[model samples]
Target: MKLSDFELDVLQLFWQHGDCSAKQIHEWVCETKPSAYTTVKTIVDRLEDKGAIKRVGKDGRAFVFQTQISKDDLTPSILPSFVKRFFAGNASSLITHLIDDEKLSDDELEYLENYLAKKKKSKS
Candidate 1:
């Protein structure tokens, strides 16, 4: 499912905290920056509408939420669109940007290399 930046941010919080109310998610989000409670709730509602999250329960008159879709589940679905939009559909350009502009550390590079190697082996 396509999520806006705000929706994705909220999802990350749900993933981290597990099932939680919109108020709890809002509180967590507000730690980083100030935003209206309604705004956060609106994002959460949108997430529900998109089927990215499900109503897990309720707490003190507020609905609790949990993820229906994982970040991994969303990755392949969104990646090609991202490549097209941001990287002009160039895989090499995406890799180059990550390596150069993203300033990935040696450890991260090694990890990604190992991951790529494993994928290549699996394909072969």
Candidate 2:
């Protein structure tokens, strides 16, 4: 299930804050994007249609929504295409970019090393 940038932004709200009404989402979005209420509602409606979110109940006249899909659910589907596009379908290139170009704290680098070690150990 591919999502547009706008859809991802809206989904992030649900993931971060749990269930909320379109108006509530609009208010939060407006803080950054200056989007209109109807625009935000349209995105919410699209998300509901896509099964990323569902109508849980009503908040007064507006419908309340909760996320059906998770960040984890979307990442595996999105990452392969992203890697294919930018890294020539090589996942190692992506990991290399993260290690070299992206900022990683010492603890984070240690964690990644440990994770790789465990993965190697499992294979062995």
Candidate 3:
């Protein structure tokens, strides 16, 4: 199922906090982007409609919800479209962009180098 940015944000909260009520999710979200409680609740409801989350229990009169899907579940589906839109559908361009735009620490660079070497060795 497709999710809007707001829905994705809400889903991420579910992934981070496990099960949570809409009020709790709103509080967390408000730390970064101030939004109304109703607004957060609306996004949560939309996420439920998309089947990305399910109501697992309740807290008082409020429903407690958790993600039905993992972050991994959505990343593969979303990445190709993201690449197509921003990187012209070329993964190498995406890699180059990351390399150029982001700072890679020595350890991070070594890890990536090792990962690439392993990938190359597997292909050979």
Candidate of highest lDDT: 2
- Which prediction has more favorable TM-score, 1 or 3? 3
Report lDDT (CA) for all predictions.
0.91, 0.94, 0.91
lDDT of 2: 0.94
Which of the two, 2 or 3, has more TM-score? 3
- Give the RMSD in angstroms, all C-alphas superposed, for model 2: 1.6
Question: Candidate 2, which ten residues in sequence have the lowest lDDT sum?
Answer: 95-104
lDDT, candidate 1, equals 0.91
Off by over 4 Å in 3: none
Positional deviation of 22 in candidate 3, in angstroms? 0.7
lDDT tens digits by residue: candidate 1, 1-124: 7788788899999889999999999899999989999999999999999999999778889888889998899999889988999989998899988788887889998999999999999999
List the candidate 1 regions with Cα displacement exceeding 4 Å: 101-124
| TM per candidate | 0.81, 0.88, 0.89
User: Relative to the unseen true structure, what is the C-alpha lDDT of residue 84 in candidate 1, on a scale of 0 to 100?
Assistant: 97
Best-matching candidate per TM-score: 3
Residue pairs clashing in model 2 are none
Sort the candidates on lDDT, descending order.
2, 3, 1
For model 1, what is the alpha-carbon lDDT of residue 67?
A: 91
RMSD of each: 2.4, 1.6, 1.5
